[model samples]
Target chain A: MLLSHPTIGRLVLSAAVTCGLAVPSYAEDILIGVATAQTGGLAPYDQPSLAGFRMAIDELNAKGGLGGKYTAKLAIKDTRTDTAATITAVQELVDAGASIILTPCDADATIAAGQITVAKRIPTLTFCGTAPVLATAVGDNLFGTYPGDNLQATVIADHAYAKGFRKAYLLVSPDSSYTAQLPEYFAEVFKKKGGTILGTGSFTMGQPDFSAIVTAIKALPEQPDLIMTAAYEPDFPAFIQQLRAAGVTTTVYGADAIGTGTVQGLGKLVDGTVYSAAGYPTPGGALEAFNKRFETTTGHAAESAYEANGYEIGLILDAAVKAAGSTDPVKLRDAIAGLDKLPIVTGTITYAGTNGMPVRAVSLIEYKDGKPVFIATQTPAAADVPAPAH
Target chain B: MLLQQVINAISLGGIYALLALGLAIVFSITGLINFAHGELMTLSGYALLAALMMGMPLLPAAVTAVAAGALAAVAMERVAFRPMRGASVTSLLLTSFAVSNLLKVVFQNAISARGKPIAMPDWMAGVVPIGSFTIGVGPLMSIAVSALALLGLELFLRRTVMGAAMRAAAQDFNTLRLVGISANRVIAVAFLLSGVLAGIASLLWIAQRASVDPMMGFVPVLKAFIATVIGGLGSLSGAVAGGMLLGVMEVALQALLPPSLAPYRDALVLSGIIVVLLVRPNGLIPAVDTARS
Candidate 1:
């Protein structure tokens, strides 16, 4: 009786065909390579993205992949978050005969892999590489699925300025390129907007002690309206907790790295802090279906905004492949670069007329009583974004 | 403002002292700068996380975590360090480094390379105000715990026979071995004491940081090494003094340095330390070749 049902029978037939038990006479298989940091400091960023990537691919394959002609098969290699290892992973994926490659989230780690994909002329998309250099310096073949970090900085600066925060104190983390660049971008926008930077401090990553920084804040001659920090996890929560505990309740503004499990772990201490990130999921927005599938696949709901960005890679690639009408590397690369206003899971993504920075809206999420609530979505104005020297 | 900054310095310094003392204890007895000691702190953090996840109360979880550190140190000494007895300092240092990396890798693969969040107790999150200044419960706890631990360690070293044997071993290892004292017991006891210090340090650190990661131990261990060098290697009192000095100097530099020069604070502080070491090569309190009183 179950097999007799029309929908169930079609599903069974699709499953059998997908498993290759029932051979299709004219079916084609396309191999996509994924070179990512499956295990390393970058793993946290890439893991969720990998999940999203798989979910998108699964959905496509289920509905008959690529005009019902090409079924995508993945060749995955772990980068281990090391440059040498990343190159090796990319080489392995390329050798596996993949037409396209997906790189890791961290820009520095993604560069070497990106170079390989560029040399091979494969269309390489990064799930969350925020550095603007990925667009300008890496290569033309390398495209980023996430918004550039400069856009995030502009959005935060504009948000703070709009909220009447005239004086700002900044904190810099000198561990990674992303953290180091955040303050520079923020200071640039804030200064340009007639806001005064009251003071600045710095800390090395993994240095748990923030008391010195706290003491410095308390000793400031004049209190700033907002405290801006560009710090990553483990250190991010520690900094926020110590600042609040020391009774310096100035509104804290930070980069996308602020929306992490570590910040959530701070309970009520993280309240009132604001940050900008890539994607914001609504109750019935584009992400609802993917989020539900992601929950079933990962057994947990998506935490980071990059999940949507990760899911976008598949949609972007599908669109590119369709536009190219061929799986040839050069043609696909050109097609992806020429993508204009193509709707993806996050929003409409277009590589046309812009540097590798994808024109997308960033969610300004603010913490209220220890939970992040969607405040507003703002698109970074092109005039507001400063071009990177590189 | 001055009063609050001073409190901040002392609280921060106390933590450094606890870490430095652990390094000092093992160094004085065995002359082995145990780089793996930081992994013991990491282990303690994991233990605390595990206990909390199991729904244990804060005090009990903290105790369990500290005990885990102590046990891990003893186990490490018994398994790894004991085999390399009478080895060159270079070999021992290499072995310690190996142990540190090995532990880090294991933790990374087993748990996560990313940090795991550990919730703080509400009591530890409170801020107490006195006059014009306010102190966080986390910092207050760190200061109180370090002081009590140091006092306890001092009493134990001064009052116990085992402690006396450790001091004698530090002064002259061969002489202590020849004088009918079991060198093995003395070394093992030194490691046990070191583990206890690291365990206590982990509790206060986790309370403040509120998260755990495999790499968490690396920076603190570096600070401990720096503090030990500055305090006078092998001198317990010197170690404590050095830790407090480093903590205070760091805070003071951050507070006083102008905004433009602020980012150079660490560089300036290290330069200052280098100048001091140039003057006092043996450190601020050079270790005297004598047993503890």
Candidate 2:
């Protein structure tokens, strides 16, 4: 009855205009703002996800756009992994009639860019950030589109327990929150699964020499069943090399931090190493097909599971857009929060009743003959998952 | 346990000493710290990787790395620094910083931000038994190769006419020119020798990490600079001693510090250096009065 009144309907359109909501039209452009790092230390992590995100966008365009009507256009801005630059890029995107926003794969940069989108009341989410704090850091509008570090650590611990690895030693790199906190959560989850932490050894990331840490681990009264460290690139190579040189060949476990092509040339040195990832290709599953499309589109193989995460971002946007029946940021944000068991290329993800981080299955992967071989995808039991670190 | 940690200290120190000696050689002759010295190492690393890709054997690839470093240094001196031959110290230092950044950006754009994985020699990845003690073969090679490089540089500096010319230039460049020794040759030889040392350091660095990136030389060079200062700037032998001391102090703290305080190891080493400087302002082995005045 209210919509039947022409004057009242005109007032509603004015109100929407005043609130900075773009009126959705059947053939109008739906701006998906992408403010991510294209170059810098974060580039290695951000680029592959960007490639997958582009693939998803291309697939949507082929299907006559989102919800088979409005054309989705990606308005990309490179943040260059700088905080001030991230803020500026986010502001520029919001001013350019953006409907939804994507942040970088890092927590600091995500929070930096998300702060502006939050202030603007736009729905924004990190494409591949694993930090749990992002869910609560940048107001209620920002959401996490990646698996949390706590969840990954729990999956690792649960899998390690299944492999009969009971005694663990944590290699903590206090230099990064990702490196530092993942091991703590792994310790908690491992303890819950009837494991004892033999000891904790510390090292700074990018430390060229890991001999001191290796010596400390070798000196442990009991050799750990597993050594868990979230250290990546340059650091992981040196650590694995030194650990081998010390003749202490305890199984090493890690998270997605080392999931890049870092282990490709490592050959037998890292053959048995295990780590958790957001997704991995099953023999004939959706992820395999998605990866094939990614290679054909990007002219290179998907670098990491982050590519899978990126594609899921598109599925989420589509689901939210369809549910909300409009591109308004406020409406889209509520629609996304209400998504339930939405199936993706990786696995089913549910955001309903969550603070914003999704509940998704994690893939346990291992390197065999210098190639990543998927082992299993499992969602750790709620009791085994550790509480998110502050 | 102590012996193993000691071996670790020596190996790590060898790299610092090698780099510090290289930095000292350039500074002693040119009166410029040459921050781009780090880029020399990175250049050598990429050259080594390229050589490996060309199907060269490991031995020849190593030679290529060393040669590439030397040639790059010579070219760098000819192109960038030669123009400002008599510039003030600040001007030369700033130029070197700019060159360093320029090279890093080029590497990032032309190559990649990710590290290129390098599969090292089997011996480097294995352990060697010294009687009842086992040590990494890579670390052992670092110590031996660096010692050999240091000895060769010392012999070259002491026994050759070019070496005396370099030392004379360090003491006072104008005086050397007054004596009719060519200043350009002395400076050129200084950069050449510095590059050779950097090549050796780069090999050791890559052996440890098994990968190379655009800015891989940054931290090693930073540590080497500190060692040069601690050893007294412009003193080659002092730089070596300072590097070994810094390496030893680092290992000691890493071994002794509690887990909660381990992150402070770098801060502690720096503070200790300050104390050493406070006690003896000229460094452990200060250079002979760099200026006759």
The most accurate candidate by lDDT is: 2
Looking at chain B only, the TM-scores across the models are: 0.97, 0.97
Regions of model 1 farther than 4 Å from truth: A1-35, A57-80, A83-101, A112-123, A187-194, A325-329, B122-131, B286-293
State residue B254's C-alpha deviation in candidate 1, in Å. 2.2
Per-residue accuracy of model 1 over B137-254 as CA lDDT, tens digit each: 7788788889999999998888999888888888888998898999889988888888888999988787778788887788789889999889889888989988998888888887
* Candidate 1 lDDT by residue in tens digits, A300-386: 888777777788888888888888877777888888889999998767888987766688888898888778888888897789987
Sort candidate 2 into its docking category: medium
Q: What share of the true interface contacts does candidate 1 keep?
A: 0.66
> What clash pairs does model 1 have?
none
